[model samples]
Target chain A: MILGLTIAIVVVALAAGALNLVLGLLGKAPNDLSLGALALVELALIAQVVTAIVAPLVGNPPSGNPIEFWAYLIAAVVIPVLAVFWALGERNRWGTVVLGIAALAIAVMVWRMQIIWTVQLA
Target chain B: MRVRASGDPLPLHYSVSVPEARSSLATGLGRVLVIVYAILALAATGRSVSQILSRFDEAPVAFTLSALAAVVYIVATIALVAKGPVWNRVAWIAIGFELVGVLVIGAISLLAPQLLGLPDINPFGRYATVWSDFGAGYLCIPLVLPVLGLLWLRSRRDAARQAATVDAEVRA
Candidate 1:
């Protein structure tokens, strides 16, 4: 996993999540700003996916279990997609909250992927 | 005497709203609940499948429990999404099972770790699956989910009944 990309996804995702949570609390639903923030996190995930494909080809292989790392990466990528669909289907503040939760989940999952990439003792 | 009902109330909207039918489980807060359940379903499925395929020999019990939890989440997610009384009942059953499963598994993992038959290679022996430790691994959301699901389902049921009562009164 690229350190820069990992840090970027984590920070952006967490920030997007906090923003959504604040929006939901303030009774705001999925607007341009909220959706745009989600798209930002989704872009980082896309970058992670691309880097995962290319980095291994360049000899910078992960030290940990590839299966575990990939599992997390895949899940991290899917959550936001699902959240977008759910948010569109229900344009309520809770829908925004769901997006926030998904963003938070992505952040945590990406962090775990990094752990599996660099620090899995097994 | 002629009776004219005010008809169904418009759904409360928070922002640019999507046009949808009124008063179903998969609306508003329930939508959030379903998304959470969907996330858990995906996570549990991925974890259980990977564990079972890779190291089922090392920890059969843990892997099996993981699979069960995955199935439960998947079922509950689908049930919550599908519209109708039947799916609602199915959701109740699935969520109720989830609550019992998490509570029982959490207690067992805490009190009697050996009962799980997990080997040392398994890092989080007792806490292997999502249900373990009442979902502490996932921030206890699993524990809170079913309780909220049941309450939401109950609330929806009451609303449906009240609507029916109003309809009956209008007709009479």
Candidate 2:
């Protein structure tokens, strides 16, 4: 994974998480803006999936466990979709909070992926 | 096949009555709790699976605890999502077990790390699982989640009871 892309994912995810968390706390319902930010996070995570696959093929296999890296990537991809389905069900402020939590989790996972990709585990 | 209460903003998909939706376990903060449980389940499952598959021999006790915690999280997540009394009881049991498990594991990890043989396989953290040292590895979320789950359960109990009564009547 490229450092730039990793940082970009982290920044966008955190921003999305913060946006949703504040809105949820304010008791705002789920709207396009809040959901769109999550959409963006999901898109970037999909990009990460592509990068993880292509980077490995292009001679950048992960320094850590491949299974671990892919496991985080797969989960990262699923979390947003799951949250979206969940928010669609609840259709309330708390659902927005779920979105926030999922985005935050993605951000954390992306950072871990970066480490797994680059840093050698002892 | 739908009913809507005045203040209850239920999903368009559920076929249940307004009362069920209004007083559901997944209403309000329960939704948030369910998501947290789901995430924790995922994390715990992943951690335990990886630990067990890759190096279970080094820290068998700790890895087994991780796997057990994973099972509890998965069960609690399902219980939170499901409706009715049986699921309610399951949720209480699972979350209650989680609370005890974390405290016990945390205490053991901190006091007697060698009981789980932590020193051998650990590369960085003091212990081998999510419940280690009261979830210190994951910023203590593991320690806190069960408490939150229990509180959420308490808050939802009456609603859950009412919902169960409605279900019973419908069945009868």
Candidate 3:
């Protein structure tokens, strides 16, 4: 992944996680704003997926274990959609908590992807 | 269904009105738990399959444990979402086994790596299972999840009982 794009994804995911966590702790359900933020994160992940696939042709291929990299990329693309669907059915503080957890997981996965990519290069 | 009070020839006009008993395990907080367990199930299954297929001979013990953890998570996720007494029993069994599995594996991996020949095949240079070192790789959620599951089960049971009592009083 491009370094700048990777950083942007991590920042957005972590910020979404923090915001959702605060809302959950306040006994609030996920509202439009929070869900919209998650949508943006999902869009970024989609972009990352495209970048990951194209980078190889463009001479910036990931040096990591290819299978693992692909697996993480697929998971990153899928988790947010699942979270949003699950959250939509739930209308309580716990619903927001679920989103928070999903956001945090995305952040962690992104960080791991970065490590997997960079370590092989090093 | 018909509800008969003790020593009453006539069935109680009121149904067995246990409102809480009708509540499924996947409501409210339980829904969140289901999502988390489902994610773990996917993660563990993928990791173990990849490990076993690519390098089974390298770390058979660790990879087998990972596979077992994946099964437990899958069962737990299903049971949490399924209805009826059968699913309730399944949830209890799955969650109970998970608690024991994590504790035993965590202890063994941390204190007795040689017992499992972990150092020879583990790429991480330490004994590692899904619960190794208290699930250090996954932020210790494995360590905490079973405990939370059991507690939630207990609370649901309590609520069912309480609702039953209330229904009985209303009938009386």
Which candidate number would show the highest DockQ if scored against the true structure?
1
**TM-score, chain A, candidate 3:** 0.93
lDDT of 3 by residue, B1-172 (tens): 1233688763363255355654468788887898888778866776667667666786678878888998999999999877666788899999999999989888887788666557732333323556766677778889999999999988888988988888788779
- Candidate 1 chain A, poorest ten consecutive residues by summed lDDT: A113-122
**Candidate 2 collision pairs:** none
Give the distance in Å from residue B92's predicted Cα in candidate 1 to where it truly belongs: 0.1
- The digit string of per-residue lDDT tens for model 2 on B1-172 reads 1245789975664455435434447778888888888888887787778777777787788889989998999999998887755787888999999999999888877788888777733323423688887887666888899999898888677665687688879889
> Quality of candidate 2's docking, in CAPRI categories?
acceptable
Compared with the true structure, what per-residue lDDT tens digits does model 3 show for residues A1-122? 67898889999999999999899889998899789878988998988888888988989877765566666677777888988988877688888988888888888888777766656621
**What TM-score, to 2 decimals, does candidate 2 have?**
0.86
In angstroms, the error of model 2 at A32 is: 0.9
Kindly provide the TM-score obtained by chain B of candidate 2 when compared with the true chain B.
0.77
Per-prediction tally of clashes? 0, 0, 0
The better candidate by DockQ, 1 or 2, is: 1
- Candidate 2 lDDT at B151 equals 88
Give per-model TM-scores. 0.87, 0.86, 0.87
lDDT ranking of the models: 2, 1, 3
